[model samples]
Target: MQADNVTRTFEDPMLLQRIPSAFLISAAVLVGMEVIGFLLLCEKHVYEITGFSVSESTWGEANEVPSKINDECAENAVMSNKEMTPLEALQTADFYLLWASVCCILVPQTMLSSLSKFFGLEYIRDDSFLAGITMASSVCNAVGRVIWGLLGDYLSFKVPLCCLLLVWTILLVTFPHLSGFEGSHLKALYSLWVCLMFFCLSGVFVFTPLASNALYGSRNMTINFGLVYSAFIIGGILAAVLTRIPQLHGQTFTQFTIGGMFCCVAFVLCLWLKDPKYPNKLKNLDVFFWFREYISLRCFHWSLGRYFRQCS
Candidate 1:
């Protein structure tokens, strides 16, 4: 056999370094101490879910079906199902609407996460507890990414994601009042609530890319999501401007309220996305139906399998 003297080049190379276990252990211990210190000093106050009685009326009016736009498919006319050219996708009204809603939703998270520890320390005069809240929120941020990614894969992304926004909106709207309460264990709730907010925010990071890939095509996912994600930069700038407000000026409430309203708006926009099944009609905007459909899908598969086994 002749000896060959050729070296293979890799198109993509990964760093082969391994993180030290000692460093990981030390970091974990430090973080655990920070969290424990926060919890130990945390004021015990009663937590209550204030405002809004849950009823059909509490959920707002039944969704109005938009008038069907004339499809009038011209012979060989390109449709949404066809892979969209980047320019064509950019020009569509839906994409920008989604972007605007995401930008609005992101502003609150950016501002709140940046200010959470400051807010807690200023109010309670406990540094450790507030630091703990910050750490918990960061951990939940990672948790939310994993959870929402799995959710998107198991259930199509749009509807359940919107429900999460609805829940997040409710939490944001009430957070200011609840956290500020003096005697109630509400302060503890505040920490948990902030973590949930971070959770929702992190999920959006996962969802936006998936949404872009589904709505446009995977071929364009990189550029399309990049354009959508630019909204985060815009959101961050808004957060920076918001910081100019004096802390005593009810700035926290103002920020949270704005975030809550934007989340609601995002939910509404999510309802408008055209369904793949019903070409003429818009997707059913019923939040309840979307919640139930996944369960129904699972049951249907189970039944079908049972029938096949019985036949065999």
Candidate 2:
């Protein structure tokens, strides 16, 4: 779904423009967080939200499990870990962790790229429902790539990222309120919301691994991307911690709050970012426009460097 050629072109300016250029990868990560958060808001999306909502809604009231804190989960009165045999407990815990991992990583990386495609299968959510949204997402995704790519080319990466983050902020924070609407209005709102969600996700096009190089610096291409990719796993691990709190169990609010907060952090971090200089983009917009940007404060021989120098 992400294009390397396009990413390469914008990498220079993106790295130069600290706001959006820096958020390129962060946007992808935040989107994953967004999906996790959105899922938390909908009971239909997560079987775990029931427990989380109950727990968070009544913070004082203990929900079945009493010792509800990280690492201390075994101390809880209900379903105490002491009851299980070492092997049985380990197996159960392993499965729980594995499933949590799937929920975390899959929702962001795969769901955005492929789930809708699968939803298109006849046996899935009634070919009628999935077909429309899935097809629309794919079509819009293709169109957005060009539009966003060009924007990254001419304008600052800040424009696209801030707008996307702002929209994402609304999406993450207000998603819960949407449920208040009734009937076809609710469905229509949800449909439109989903489209907007996809729109923000297009930020990934600008922030792909190819783009990461220009923003961070191409000198350490392999290492930078390697570290960035690790974020997915790390984010997944954090998701587990956020979702499986003993009290909240698996609530939509847990994920949503976490995602909302993460998005804010990404946005803030982007404020300090700068764009990389790649004059080639102007000359060969056809070629470099679609290429990736490898970024680093040191790499930008442009405005971003001047800002860093002044800050120091």
Candidate 3:
């Protein structure tokens, strides 16, 4: 499976053939999932419709549901003064920078998600323990969303970003050493570490939308967010390639180190980011003052509006 040289990898006929097959298989799997989900929804609707003929009261109750949903949907559909066109949002430098930051974090985050189970088994060799650990990690992911949201409200996005990247970098560096542990101790330690890593990774999803609205404006959010999220697909591709390195004559530890380096770079990028809600003059001031302003809800909105006016 080892390539003699870089040219040999490109020249390998079988490897090239497998590339297309892999892509086809992945596409088929995605399409299958969507098709199955759509069919299930259709089946449910058909059942509901059939039931209406059997019971008018049931249909009456169901009919009221759509109006409630319309009311909920109407709230989001309303246009606001702050909304920007998608094209306008795309032209900003912040858009590209934000996209790149997300791409960086997601590469390793994808790796951890896919490989953690293998890593757990490699260390402890316990199937039951791995299953339990994965379930616990899912809970950690949910807790992380709530925790990071509150952190952003209490402080600023920058503080959470810095802390997350720093911790994530450290985790990546130390992850390769987990192979040395054994038995119940290893399971306990490995589960805790992986859960914490998952917690850190969850911040990107929670922060991205909030940060997008804050920086790019809410008007073109749907299109702008869609464009920004394309970085996630790019990250998945990078992670897929990186994960293969170990099988292709590269070391897993080195691949992980590369991921940690990306986090370091992301941390540096975060430091350069200016808050759209605050004037440039206030960007470099103390974090304590930033939190003070953030804690005052009405004052914060008023200041942000003034900042927008000054920029406009």
Order of models, best TM-score first: 3, 1, 2
Worst 10 residues of 3 by lDDT: 72-81
lDDT, candidates in the order shown: 0.67, 0.49, 0.72
Q: Which regions in candidate 1 have their CA more than 4 angstroms from the true location?
A: 1-82, 245-250, 275-312
Q: Tell me how candidate 3 scores on lDDT.
A: 0.72
lDDT of 2: 0.49
Off by over 4 Å in 3: 1-83, 246-250, 278-312
Instruction: Decide which is better by lDDT, 2 or 3.
Output: 3
Query: What lDDT tens digits, residue by residue, belong to model 3 across residues 129-186?
Result: 7778888888999999999998866454766877899999999878877778777777
Q: All candidates' TM-scores?
A: 0.60, 0.45, 0.62
lDDT for 91 in candidate 1 is: 88
Which candidate number has the best TM-score?
3
- Model 2 Cα lDDT, one tens digit per residue, 1-312: 211242322245544577666579878998999999987894455445454444565766656345454432222222211232323423432223322322333234333343223312312233355547766766767777777787765443544655666676667666545557765675566557656667667765454443344444445556544544555676666655655568744344445555656666555444333334333233244232233233333356677778889999
Superposition TM-score, candidate 2 onto the true structure: 0.45
Candidate 1 has a TM-score of 0.60
